[model samples]
Target: MAALSRLLLAALLAFAAPAFGLAQQPAAPEAEAPQVLRFRFKPPADGRLAYRIVQRDRVVFAGTEKARAWSHVVEVRVGGARPPDMLEATITLSDVRLDEGPADDPYYLVAKTLEGRALPAVLHDSGAPVETAWAALKREVAAGLARHTDPETARGLAAALDRLDPEGVTVLYRPLYLASVGHLLGFNTDGSVRSYDDYTGPGAVMVDGRWAASAAGRREGEPVVLELGWRIGMDPDAAARALGPVLQGLAEAAARPEDRAAVKARLAAELADGMEMSERADAEYDYALALIARFTHRHVLATAGYGKEAVLEMERIAP
Candidate 1:
């Protein structure tokens, strides 16, 4: 009977040992530290790269909510194996949807019209378009302009209507513009220097197989893997200098409360005149597009209130 009791006690303790051991087990070997990959910007070789970009924009004014979202796939190909290369990019927009809260929204209309169109563009090292791919965009915007009846906004848009380069409009509306700008900024003129440090923040890291930056302790992968935070505002002095007498008159007129409405009207007319002048006097559209691209890229990266958000995911499709 003594031997039997001892055997039974041994069995009971053996049964409880595993449960006790589990309670003190060392936490599964500390989850094996996450694999981290430090990103280095390599000058892209002569290969094709593909990416899917999702863009979301939302606006709220006077308790009215309006939202517009779209997704597009971009394909970029590098032509030369060496520096001073040419880039051929194609953007195809899809899944564009809009939710407007019973408010008059023309932007929603524009987005709807832009869906399902693949725009192909080519650019040289200087960011000059090698092909005229603005025909489709010009047609679309012209139609929208004709249909747009809002006086307050229409005038401003109409003022710069003819001067609207597809590249400039694209930079305003899509994330692929950033990719183009990034490509240009990533490589030097001769493709000798590849510096990505200027575009990445201290918190940038690879997380879950994607490059991400920590903002407010949360990882964000949008438009860029890292936040460049490039904000280049239009220099008022430069604008004043460029406008010369026109800016002076507008400034003087805007100083008076009574002349505000008149000043606005004059401003619109002057802008229209300036567009006409730009078209007739010089072929500065290419240069203007370059400037606009840089400005728009910086503006998108810097401004949080624009309600514009873009996510860029890169996949190496070929060697």
Candidate 2:
């Protein structure tokens, strides 16, 4: 009787095993490699977003040096119906907390215009910025140039801007450009640097008169990280020769002839020694790769045994 009861219990256990998932089952297949950083972005717009900015720099001369750093926030708004593939936004940078800042910095003084100012920032995946959007930013910059200087000086400044490389401007100086377009930059998850043009073949870099650059990618925690940088290329002699007329013009507008000569002489002395330039733009992004968590674009140029480094960073504030 006991053996029969035991047999009955064994049969009952065997019958319930499949229902409870206790039976042997085939192993699940392993997950395939992720298609990392293939840009399938859905631009987030029609709302408000805040981004924090941080920048730092130091100039080293022989044994003496100068360094500075600052951080602030900018609020962006893009209303109306959101586009499925693009974002058009206006950024307002005014009345925000600056967690870090430096005193007696001329560049900072000019950049202060950033606060309380509204600027156009657009994000699209055209591989290059649309002409209209580029013109919009250039217009804002042109307006600022006029507001800050005499007509002659403004014209000189505009000339200087005209001489500037669009690629360099889009990369480092224009915060809005980086904020809106950095994500659209091409990246490779295998840590190989390639040209922005996908058809350019592997190991090739995007080249222009001012820069030869590309970005590499890797996984970092929950975000995709990209390491991008520039190889500084400028002939000091060429630069000095080009800068003399602009400086003289500006000085003519605002200072005495002697002052103008003195300024030109000073700048010539400064750029006399050719510089070696290097830069880095490292960025990290979340799941959708929508926004960079932290993006730092830094440059260090060495001349006459001295080095000057400038750094700029942008971070998105958590909602």
Candidate 3:
């Protein structure tokens, strides 16, 4: 039986080797997968971008001026016997407006070229150096756009794109700000607010004022990072009107230790209503109240700064 078990194990190992393509392993182990390139396009500028990935002096992959808002994926396998060296490259951007671009321009191109296209030319040229793809891809893109009127040429361009691997190319762009009073952005490991400004690779952009983050690429299980910041230019009256009383109540409760439980209960009830708080303290109070209700094992509502009369009002639910 022991000998039979050893033979079974040997057979399993052999089967697993083929499953992992280990039987076809070259003299050297497979090279590590190339890291995806990252790019950031913040507000106030737009321009086209292009890129080419060359391996063994052949354009393994090439793309031009895709929109930034639409994430893209491109992949290319430099098919050959010898190991291929992957080269990554990008283009520089100048201002171009979305309104000015050709009507047929793809969504990804619009996103990539946003900084140059969206903002004023003067402001666009002024702010900062926008990163983009390589010159060769840009040149090809320009040539391709010129052929848009020619059906055959346009078809060839589309076919070329189809051949390119659609695994790595991605784009992210900011959308309009909401009218909400407050939002929670994400943070980096070092505690700085994460922003498109700080992005060096494809990362999530919390377009809806920091309460959410969406990854730029479709790669499975990629980590999405967030950082919170207040949006300027929102109406102060709106925020104040929304937050004032809630903030005051939280302040009062925080100051009264004996009333903490009642305060917590109130916060929990507010949270249960699916209300969005304009102040961080109120949000924290809601979170604290939730934790107490979940884990405290005893009701603390009597001490929630509410007198006996108020306690009676809550007693039905407090237990």
Candidate 4:
């Protein structure tokens, strides 16, 4: 019986050894390399979705729209020895999130396009010239503005230009032409400024110029009002260089206590609109002046709000 027990134990040990050895073996390698980023979004307009892959602020690929509902599946090649490539198709849900991996991942090569494709962004493919497109667009806009200063034309064109994918020439150049025409003659007659904090409030700025106007809205925190506006006139190049200093000076002055008071007093006199007298009104006045001053510094007439980030748009402007 003792000998039989020993034999049985030996047999069990032999079977267990093979099972354990198989478990210790390394697992099969990953099927495909990790992807860079994956996003899902509902189709817009035609539901035909296209992807613009960017890397280092340059667009590498604008994928052809693969329409299958709103779902898209984009595979951005990350790193390694070659330029990141796209996967089979973008056939995922419209609300997909991104999953990024190591730098060595191929996806990083195409990350720029992902970032640059924002609503108000420009896409520049590696084969395209973002700077040149910007420059040409700016030049066309400047030339057009020189010819006509129509606010509708200017604003329309600016908005259109802003929509271009920085990667392609056609997309970049269209806005330039539109903006140029607008700057030459772009001013609307209906100039209205209302304070949201105090409707019919006194703490707002309204300036309708030969080609542009300044509009103010109610202030958020503090009893101040926010101001915004656009205008078109003057030589695009000369204005950018010459008026830039003046605009900067105004920005500085508006932020100053004394200057803020002076501007408010002047605005009241100009509009003859009832002034809502309050110490806080100075802030609203200052805000308007600052925006105006900044506007003066703008060489290119952009219709949207870029604020201090205006420099990014400026850098893209054509010479």
Best by lDDT: 2
Give the alpha carbon lDDT tens digit for every residue of 196-225 in model 4: 221221111111211232233333563433
Over the stretch 1-319, how does candidate 2's per-residue lDDT look in tens digits? 1221222212111211221111112223463432335444333554666667776766443244455676567676654433665556666655433234334232343344345776655545422222223344544555665554356655655555444445333422345454333445454454444343222211111223233334444454434543333222333444334433443443233335566566455444544543333344555555454555666665544433334456777877743
Which sequence of candidate numbers ranks them by lDDT, best first? Answer: 2, 1, 4, 3
Task: Give per-model TM-scores.
Answer: 0.38, 0.54, 0.18, 0.17
Residues 1-319 of candidate 3 have per-residue lDDT tens digits of: 1221222222111211222111111222364432322222212112222211110100000111111111221111111121132222222222322333233333234234332332211111111212223222433453554333345434544444433322213221111111011122222322222223321221111112323211111213422322122212112233224433443343342335686566556544333322221111000101211111110000001111111100000000121
Q: Arrange candidates by TM-score, highest first: which order?
A: 2, 1, 3, 4
**What is the lDDT for 177 in model 1?**
36
Shift of residue 241 alpha carbon in model 3, Å: 26
lDDT of 1 by residue, 1-319 (tens): 1221222222111211222111121223355433222212232454444444444433322223344444444444545422356555454444544332322233333444455665666655533334435555655654564443355444455455454443443432334333334323321221121223233211111012111111101014322223221211122233223443443342332245676566455444433322100000001011211221111221111011111122233222223
In terms of TM-score, which candidate is stronger, 3 or 4? Answer: 3
Model 2, stretches more than 4 Å misplaced? 1-42, 80-87, 95-107, 111-114, 117-173, 179-181, 195-208, 220-273
Superposition-based RMSD of candidate 4 using all C-alpha atoms, in angstroms: 31.6
Of models 1 and 2, which has the larger TM-score? 2
Worst 10 residues of 2 by lDDT: 197-206
Please give the lDDT score at residue 65 for candidate 1.
34
Taking the candidates one at a time, how many backbone clashes does each contain? 1, 2, 54, 47
Top TM-score: which candidate number? 2
